[model samples]
Target chain A: MPFPQFLFPNSKFPSQVRNIFLFIRRYFNLLLFLFLQGFSIYLIVHNSRYHNAIFGSITNQLTGKVNEQFSRVEYYFQLKKTNDSLVKANAKLYNKLKADFELPDTTSNIFVDSLKVDSIETYRKYNYYPAKVVYNSVAAQNNYLVLSRGTAQQVRSGMGVIDPNGSVVGVVTDVSKDFAVVMSLLHKDSHIEGMLLKATRKQAHSAGMAWRPISLTFPGYRKVRKWLWETASYQVATVPAYQKV
Target chain B: MNTLVKNIVRFALFILVQVYVLDKIHLHQMVTPYIYFLFILWMPFRMKRTWQMLVAFALGFTLDSFHHNPGFHAAACVLIAYIRPFLVNLLIPQEGADTNYEEPSFKSMGGFLPYFIFTGVLTLIHHGWLFLLEAWQFGNIWYFIFKTLLSTAVSLVLIVVTELLFARKQSFRTNTA
Candidate 1:
């Protein structure tokens, strides 16, 4: 295996030819490294902002497929925890229904729609379109999530995303027609406005990786109680101040 | 397992862990541990350059696809793979030029310090090139140095810890190529 047959065909031809072949084989590593490094540099230098948009989408499409497969396998491992949360949520909903029925009917025994039939219409400021997480990460300095739904289904950048249990997962950062990327709370650049539930003090904290203490950056306060939860794979902590709905 | 099959499996496992696990860990603003490079570092010492470079490219490209930075990781990987043989020669001259050493672990490398230095220096080089290329436009010399050093430290610690916890002792074998 000193030299492949294709490179050293007719080794019997001449001594000089064999010598050249041997030399090439000896230094082949250097040649290959230079060629590869040049190509890599070309890719880095030629990738303009205009091309990044196109490239980014292409990468997302490719990674989305593979990551979706991985997430499926990971989903099995978390089924018990997910199931537990679902059961708890169902019980809460059941209790709420029971409490509502317990209220005495002031008008009649039959249930009646209570809203006045007015000419005016109502609109919702925020619409939650549930999407499954196709991919998620908690280890990177800048973590991102890939959602199964995308712009085709009304998912867009700046839209809020939450887990099944209603935690502040992240906000949609990029959107393709059929896939979307979310900059998760674990990202270093991620900053969400929050206020302590028990106190009136407002502060801003930069998000850290899961299970790590999130750092408080605003108001220059160093003594704030940093919450560290034994976070799960799919659900991390939700900022109480920013918890809407 | 045969060397070929073992390397293939290692390549896949390293890529998977890098993309899904290590990539998610943001220990600090400056440090991002790239443990996947361990795949290249730990490859059988006797493997040919062509195969090593090819495998390195594939590993880096896979990571590049996940990281969404085309060719960055691949370039760094190729660079390190290119220099690996030279580093082996310089560091382990006692093995002689012809010895086909097994996978580089603490036991195989004779002791902890050689293995540590080998893994650490290679990791530093890889991380240095990676961060430099990534922060090419930043033009802040201090920032680049800080990031490279910090990331190298984190990666070194993780690699050392992983080797200690998972590496199994194997009887040393030597063959002449």
Candidate 2:
């Protein structure tokens, strides 16, 4: 009688449900598109891809900014403790920095002094940049974190971001001149190599929502992936050689 | 602003809001807002089918750009856009009635139920895909199912509340207040 009925000749729903089904049938491609999109979102959420993660750089910038703003109020309360830590750190590193790198005569110093370790790039092994979180969206299937630092700040895509708590946040995905976005560990499109802090020191690609505490998944549970799932504080590390290019 | 400027601003604003405001929420350990899909839901009526699909793809892509996950959101949004025409035609009963009308507003569609159904089904479809893709090999099917249902519920509720609060300009006899 109508376009929908013309499209749905085989569905078995009551008249009311059939009407809806018929309509959906008429637009089957959209449904397929939607389904595939959902599936793709799930893939992004669970799979791993450094060059194409959905929530990498922007998410980092965003969360970094929010945390910074929040820290303002937080700093007010934790000022004493923060200052105390700063003084202790300053006192400890001030002499060490001068002695380590600023040494008048270069001795056989195998290790660089930890005092000059403030910037990530200062170390040859890792590149680092200071950034502010400008935007962060973790509530979606593909959550993103944005940062205020970009090419100007030498913040490249694929660098790992972490909270002070040692928990893995995500990696840098994109960077503009003054802004960068990161994918958070809690994002549906998130995955990272994480090692359990236990004696076994198990490692797996941590994937799951930042929402669900028990959401993280480890692959190859065929033998002992299940056993290694118990508990661990995770960290995000940069994949070198790839991001620099 | 003209319609073009208005729509552009709307798109950018939503993206900004989604990333800056909604993404910061950490409820129980998992993120909650996931409202980037709202862009697809809130689009104006009368847009072309092909354009709508393109917009859906673009919406997902933009969101994907915000994160590092590509193709996933783009795919989901495009699907929803493709299906939108079918949903509207079924709900509106276009039997030589106002075919050229510019929107799927409540007045043209007869009521909120049709609109709700249209939006709700698409929402479910989108969330379901998102959850399953994230699941990959699967640990607990129930958890994924629960996430789909719960997230759908929240998104639908928000849509309903927003419609009610806005008192949109179109008030047809068939539409709900």
Compared with the true structure, all predictions reach lDDT values of: 0.69, 0.58
Single out the weakest 10-residue window by summed lDDT for candidate 1 chain A.
A211-220
Clashing pairs in 1: A138-B24, A139-B24, A139-B25, A139-B26, A140-B23, A140-B24, A140-B25
Q: Per-residue lDDT tens digits of candidate 2, residues A119-166?
A: 332344444444555455544545666666777777777777754433
Candidate 2 residue spans exceeding 4 A from truth? A1-47, A53-129, A136-144, A155-245, B1-5, B28-31, B34-38, B42-45, B93-101, B137-140, B171-177
Q: What tens digits encode model 1's per-residue C-alpha lDDT throughout A54-128?
A: 567777787778888888987998899989988976775665564567575342321233364642433333455
Candidate whose lDDT is highest: 1
Judge candidate 2 at residue B55 and give its lDDT.
77
Per-residue lDDT, model 1, residue B135, is 61
